[model samples]
Target: MSWRFVSLPPQDGYHMVTSFVSVADYVSRGGRNTLLVFSVKEPFVNVGVHQEVWLEVDLDYTSKAGIPVVRRDLGGGTVVITRGEHDYFVVVNQDEAPSDPKALYAKYLSPVVEVLRDYGLNAQLKDQDIVVNGKKISGNGAMTHGKAVVLAGNILMKLDVDLMSKCIRVPTEKFRDKMAKDMSEWLTSLERELGYVPPREELDKKLKASFERNLGIKFEDSSLTSEEIEEWERLAREKMEEEWIYYKDRRHPELRTERCVKISSSVAICHVDYKARKLLRITAKFLGGKLAEVSISGDFFVMSPKGFIELLEERLTNLSPEDIPKEIDRVFEEKKPTIFGFTADDLKKAFLEIVNKPEVREVI
Candidate 1:
């Protein structure tokens, strides 16, 4: 059967990528082999299945940084992606790929591993992760959409270690410094390792060659059909909405902390706590578009909790209501954690409701 290879414009957020996945799901339901490749404009923190955004990120810090937080339907550790990273999503009917999930990952990733080797990166597939020098460089996840299985991952061609460390919330006292160093040692970028950046087109070509060689298939370059494009736009809009981006589900508030920020919006509530040193609890309520409440909690150590809260409050006062989510996302992006399963949007909604309640609105 002929395979369709469609390259899409760079999508900046999880919602857009997931929208494309919806299109792939539709195509795969019709028994087509679909490969979608796209890039993103900004960096975003993506959580895996069975992970909570609050548990994995430092909301207090992230809300101030303007980073975007997202939760993927697939399962894996949380990952940070910026413009320097390249991502791929492949959707194939079950009959088109191996039935066994493990086998399917191997079959699909063989090409990526080969391509990395050709670039002299010494890339190898270990278990379900793609490793370079025994450190994970690429991680892939698979999910079933209709009758098709979708495989998606990113190649960290170049990443900002300091920024990544600052973007995620981690547990150790020196976690930020340690992660910056560890990531530098564990991950390699084509630009850093080769001392020059490869053109995007060239990289795509190399990946295509590797895919053809390993999968024994020919790919025909194509564009999305009108039907697919229409569907994509519709889905993208829905994904970007508050309902999908935040408050998709509700659960008991698990973690809590207290933080303060100095912003025009007034004393916005800020809460943050840690687990294993990573962000575990994050709640921020805005008062008059300012932070009114900030709480942090979890099974993590925090020396001078009062000091941390005061610092956050000062920062919150400086932030605008619109900046809240970005700030929260930045904290999570810098601080990496195991993640519990809640999403940033989930916490955001809770905080928003708590802080932004209408003058006439009342909590039950």
Candidate 2:
């Protein structure tokens, strides 16, 4: 299908973010698939949908620096968007995009990989990251927006590593130094590798052509619909309020303890401790509200298949909140993996304590 293509001039934080959201809402209401490309002209800190402002960022630093901190309606880690990064949002109908995570990332990120490779960088998609060699060059994030799947990512042309590290809250200046060093090694930009950043006009043209050739679709240059503009205005107004910037902190003041951090409506990182006959600690990474990565530790004994803990962790993957205790009990009954000290009730309570909380506001 022919997609509507709108390449915006470098915009401020407000328009850059809300444009994709408005377009995604447009698609949800039966508008055409869109490929919106733009860059941020002003420096700003974009907090992930689920990131805690106090835990993750240095508000005093950002506020003093005149860099507005805004929470985007998408999953991923906090990102520092400034003058040099170019971003693209693929807002497509759910039916048009692949539902499988791997398939979706490969399909959407391949164009960027191709563009990077053409620019003499060995760019490839390593899981969710667009990497050059082993270092990440682009950080991509995705989530469903109504009837659309919104995949957003950016190419770092000239990253200010020092500024980024300083914007994040750390316990000490010593730790911040360590973080800056690590960030420099972990992330790369065109300027760092190529001795110069590519011209914006050149990169933009190349990206448009690369996307078309890679995705087997043609783009017809278009503008946002009146409905999308109206929605953008409303979203902009809402996003500008302090509540939206610190939404997570405002809603769940208790999670100030950093027990759970939601990346999106369906994805979260959670932790909880349950006391039974022993101190049971559970750290879980949830995907689609199901336990994706589960780590159980602290004073527990397991009767073994040699790898009973591993097997149990694997089994917990993709199990919903209601199924956790039932599965634990089933495992004990059928597999006899006999985890001593903590009963399924302890496990259930721990799971409920973390998952059933006021975290990400339910999208539905």
Error of 1 at 309 (Å): 34
| TM-score against native, each model | 0.67, 0.73
Model 1's lDDT to the true fold?
0.62
Candidate 2 per-residue C-alpha lDDT over 1-364 given as tens digits, one digit per residue, 9 for 90 to 100: 6989888878878777788889989999998889888888889888766455776689899988998888777655677898878888999998888876668889988988999999999888986679998899998777776788888889999989999998988889999999999999999999988999998778878888898998889989999888888989899888888888876566444334337677687767766767876556667776765666676543443422235555666777788777888888786676764343466678778777867755522311
lDDT for 36 (candidate 1): 75
- Candidate 1 regions off by >4 Å? 246-249, 254-364
Clashes of each: 70, 1
- Relative to the unseen true structure, what is the C-alpha lDDT of residue 184 in candidate 2, on a scale of 0 to 100? 92
Candidate 2: worst-modelled 10 consecutive residues by lDDT: 297-306
Highest-scoring model, lDDT: 2
Query: Which number leads on TM-score?
Result: 2
Tens digits of per-residue lDDT, candidate 1, 104-194, equal: 7799998888878888887888765698878776867676666667788867777688777877777764977888899888877777767
Residue 343 accuracy (lDDT) in model 2: 68
